[model samples]
Target: MKKSTFLVFIIVYLFFSISGFLFPFDSDWYRTLAKPDWTPDGSVIGIIWAILFGFIALSTAIVYQERGFGRHNSEYMSLLGINYILNQVFSYLQFNLHALFATFMDALFITITTLLLIFLAGRQNRFAGWLLLPYFLWTAFATYLSWLFYSLN
Candidate 1:
């Protein structure tokens, strides 16, 4: 991918990352809720999300480089858009609304979209698909965590 293109993707991802600040995690609320013993600390979760976003940006740029806009790759683009929105919405649903069930469902969709993106991107660029693997795995784990949160709280 060209440097400019990669830089643009990184900027877009960073823009999406701003949602975390807008709907900052409610640590006080979160602490009162029952949590799984295996749950990672807030800082750890933040670090992991930061790394995953970087991976997502790189993978998206690589996919775009390999398969530019066209009817041929519309589905890939659509999934990417859906995934991005769902990814950002999680913070609002979890932190602001405190809707554990909705957040759990959102996490499920994120995982599904990530898996679909992986398949679609892999068909065009294997490296892009590989890059998304961490995101997919993280979302899957997050879904489980959300489910537990919903059940426990």
Candidate 2:
């Protein structure tokens, strides 16, 4: 992949990462909730997301490099777009709106879409698909956490 193209993907994914800052979590509200003892620290979550976003950007760039936005690869591109949007929207739903159930559902979709992206990317580029494995695992774990939050609180 061209360095410029990869940089662009990194920039776009970084923009999506800003949602956490845009909708900063309500710490006071968060404190009131019944969280599991095993819940990760907020800083840890932030770091994990930062790493995942990097992975996502690289994976996307690889896929785009291998298969541009041609008609034959439209589904791959479409899924990327959808997954990005869904990924950004989770912050608003969870932190801003305080919608636990909705956030849980959003996380669920994110997990599902990540899996689909893995499958699709694998067909085009094995490395790209493998790159998303951490993202998929994290999202699956996140979906479980979301469900726990919804059910516990």
Candidate 3:
């Protein structure tokens, strides 16, 4: 990947990471919830996100390198935009609204969008497609966890 493309990915990753600050963790609310036995702690969540974001940045940079901002890869670009927006929406639902059900549904959207992106990337760059596996697995696991929260609460 070009330096410029990598820079863009870094900017995007930072933007999302910083935006998370807007949603402060509510210990009071969280403590009352009936989470599963295997629910991870805050530190685990942070570590997962850091690794996931790294994968996302690298995958995005790879795609950008393979297909620059051109008409040929417009579909890939569109999926990326959709994934970004839905990811933010999921965060909003989980944090601001504190709506577990809504967050779970939004997570499903994210997982589907990511799967689609993987399918599209596979056509152009197999490496990029394989790179998203960790992301997809994490998001899918998140979706399941969110659903549990919704159902339990």
By lDDT rank, best first, the candidates go 1, 2, 3
> Per-residue lDDT for 67-153 in model 1, tens only?
775788899889888998999899999999999999999999999999999998899889989999999999999999999999999
lDDT of 2 by residue, 93-140 (tens): 988899999999999999999999999998999998999999999999
TM-score of each: 0.94, 0.93, 0.92
Per-residue lDDT of 1-153 in model 3, one digit per residue for the tens?
Answer: 578897968976775565367676666777788999999986788788877777777777777787775899899889988988888787678777899989999999999999998888777789879988888998899999999999999
Please report, in order, the local distance difference test score of every candidate based on alpha carbons: 0.90, 0.88, 0.82
Candidate that beats the other on lDDT, 1 or 3, i.e. the better one: 1
Q: Per TM-score, what order, best first?
A: 1, 2, 3
RMSD, each candidate, Å?
A: 1.3, 1.3, 1.5
**How many backbone clashes does every candidate have?**
0, 0, 0
Worst 10 residues of 3 by lDDT: 15-24
Query: Candidate 2: misplaced stretches above 4 Å?
Result: none
Stretches of candidate 3 exceeding 4 Å from the true structure: none
